[model samples]
Target chain A: MEKKRLYWRICCVAAIILSIITFTPLVIPQGVSKPELGGVPYSLWTSFVITVLLVILTYIGTRVHPGMQNEEEDL
Target chain B: MIFWVWVFGLIYAGLLVFASLRSYKKNRSSEEFMMAGSNIGLTLGVLTFAAALFSTFTFLGMPDFFRINGVAAWIFLAVSDGAMVFLLLWFGYHIRMKVKGMEFRGVAGLISRCYENRLAGYVFFLSSFLFLIPYVGIQIQGIAIFMDAAFPGSFPAWGWSAGIVLIMLIYSEIGGLKAIIFSDAIQGLLLLGVIWIIGWACLSHFGGIGPMFDKIGTVQEDLLSSPGPQGLLTPQFLFASLIAILMIPVTQPQFTTRIVVMKSMKTMQLMAVSLGAFAILVILPTIFIGMYGADLYSEYGRDEFFANAFLYDQPDAVAALAIIGLIAAGLSTTNAQIFALGSELRGLLRGNENSIMTKTKIGIFVFSVIAFFFSIIVIDQLVLLARVSFAGTGIMGPMIILGILSNRKVSPAIIYLSLTGLIIFLLSLGGWIPDMYFDIRLDLILFITLGIAAVISHLTGTKRQLIRPKTKE
Candidate 1:
């Protein structure tokens, strides 16, 4: 049950981050000279960067499970 | 036009055959063959997952979408990656635990046993088989299309189809999943290289990204917008697409097998992250290539858009490389699909206790034949067919999730709810009823049906009764 709770918490945090990234353009006004890199919009790059960071954080948090210690035994 | 393209293809096919035979020799038991003795580590697991996700669809169809719609096509990359991460976090651990000490011959068997219902298992097996065959067929057809376009005069479409299928059969028959993964790792790397090169070339030709988009801004401003044309990605559609993407890994028999194949939860988690990164990086270029192609085509007519705009007048070398890359992507995914279907069918026909080698060989033969026939006969629009098939799986997602959450003993009431959801979705798809009874998308109608089913299942204590633990002797 603790593992399940931790999993859900991780999911909720990630989902919140994704939602913010996906919906940011709706909040930001258009006049800002957000430099376009490689034909991709600046807002998109921002969102992608945030997503990458979230992914990294989630990966680290999830890996703390004690079950992971028995990795070598699986082989 | 390019002799080396054929040479490369032929050599690749030969290697696949040799690897397949080697895998067959190494496979001593069903567990060894099906799940790689449950010893796969992060590298191979991540590679296979990325390869499985990036298919002919990404290679051929993505470029077309980019050419037609511009940058919005990149949404798929996020969708695919996000879906993988979500699945890994939400369900991967439980799946690993459920099949930890067991030899799960197929996803259907795993789910059915969990739900304590042979009927559900059989239905899930049949549904996966039916829906997945067309997907495999599309991959086969994609290979044929790429070869036809690349070689032009030398290799006919049928020859290309036959050659790819033959190669797939050789490895799949011999090596099972192991051979498939090994080849897929190589193919995935090659695909990444090819797409990067194409993206670089396009940028170089266009005088960099800013100027390219500046040109596009003059024509279609909506192309640059988030919602995109006609709000094709309305909030509801976006939500549906998200749900569809999340549910896909769970419902897909091929993907679920990956869960069973990994040696440990740590490997699975590592695989999820690595695969997510690989998928994102590889797909980013495809979107750029699409946007580039779209810009080029705006000057030319849209009819000659994807193939002609990008490669029609380019040098033979570049065109041929692009063709080979596309074919590789298609064949890699197609081979995996064939293997998956074969594994599922083998488990159903002879039970999970059968010899893996013999079952795999037979599966190869059966699936290859089905793929060949379906590719030849299915004359409908490929994209439409793919979408319809994906939507069909949506109906099964609820049942699979409920079954898993309930520890596999799903209430009959939940099963009835699942059936009701399936019916509504089918009705919506077939146009038996208009979508807007009072301005609602038909998909929402089905989702509502699913919600009601869940409520009824909850209120009536259906889950409690169905999932009650059995007394031990």
Candidate 2:
């Protein structure tokens, strides 16, 4: 239970951090030459990567629950 | 070309009807019909959730958004969707626990019960209805606009709107939520496949991704960076938008009901992650398709650009398939929201269960009509209009969280604050009031104020009521 709460807080903080960096002028400034990564802007790539990264972390957090781990029946 | 398009449409419609009939046979009771017997598996849940969440907006509106706003459009949607998935993890767990302990039928009922007042439910329902009717209409309207352009004077846009709404009502009434989920899974797959196929075609037209973006840089350099040419994806706009979209699972009855009915918490959690991944897969292609538009059709009007890119640019076969896919996209999303309103009405109606079912069915038809009429009047710019709907409904998020997550009977002040916040935000949106308070977006300010009010109300009213998580017996 404590571990779940810890993960929950981490997820929330991660969300805020994501919003802060991507939506604000903290890292990627507005109306400038954005670096390209794989044919897309580096800023956009970072946002997508951060999103996937955090989701994986949250998925790992769900493994703390016994029912989640054992209930593997495919729909 | 038209013959093939009609054939695909008819086949898709036939399959949907067959799936609905299968579900109808199993849904012998009202509860089963409305709630899918409350144990939907992970696959159907994820597909339905994703199909409902991304629709014509992803297909048509998003490409247009990128054509205009540039690459920041990616961050605006993808990052917000990620936050929404994370929220589904956090909010879904607590709300499911809340549902297990209560005899509530919808978020409306649960929230009302938490506040111990019927008005809270009504307020919640009214907020959704006010925003969602237009949102649903935009889905239909988007396709109607395209239909008008594709067939040009064959049927009026309003006729197209009415026709689609009738189709949606027939299937939803036939099998209810289960049927909708079944069809949603089908639509989900078609939408993903068709978009990728078209996206690849568009990318191939420009040689490749790097060359395509390089071409865009030469044509319009501003589009390659932030604030685009239109300056629409501003920092404040994106930040407040993240808040609005993140609240969707909490505030939108369609998604809320979906989370509650999943076979288990594990299913809902997995569905959340899948939805995030699905969002990335689905939205990424729109960027390519939009870049194609920016290169060739930048000066064309919205309707012309959509028709040329979506239809004229493709081979007849793929374009025909895309027509069916667009119909599937628009109808899947429209059905979910309109039917959710029915489910919400069922939750709030005061009557015997049988009579409530009758009334709710009637209510769904009425709402569909309202949506059809709303569709005729809505202008183009599908994604932005849809975002307005998200923002409008999202103002109720704090009140809902307070209701679902608090152990003590929450103070009535929270409800009032939410209502006040919703009204101000709406007025601000309408230009009857200013949009910013102290240079902050009114919606953002409202969220903050509502959060503070909830805290103050909770602190003043309850000294020691612990919000203990409900353990299963």
Scoring each candidate complex against the real one, what DockQ results? 0.29, 0.50
Residue-wise lDDT of candidate 2 within B141-251, one digit each (tens)? 888888887788899888899899988988988888999999999999999999999999999988998898889989998888778899888888888888889899999
Which stretches of candidate 1 lie above 4 Å from their native place? A1-11, A20-39, A64-75, B153-156, B298-306, B313-315, B350-364, B379-385, B435-438, B444-448, B451-473
TM-score of each: 0.86, 0.95
Give the chain A TM-score for each candidate.
0.43, 0.56
Score residue A59 of candidate 2 by CA lDDT: 73
Q: Which number leads on lDDT?
A: 2
Q: Report the error of model 1 at residue B437, Å.
A: 5.5
| Residue B242's lDDT in candidate 2 | 86
Q: Which portions of model 2 miss their true places by more than 4 Å? A: A1-8, A65-75, B463-473
Query: Scored by CA lDDT, what does every candidate get?
Result: 0.64, 0.84
Best by DockQ: 2
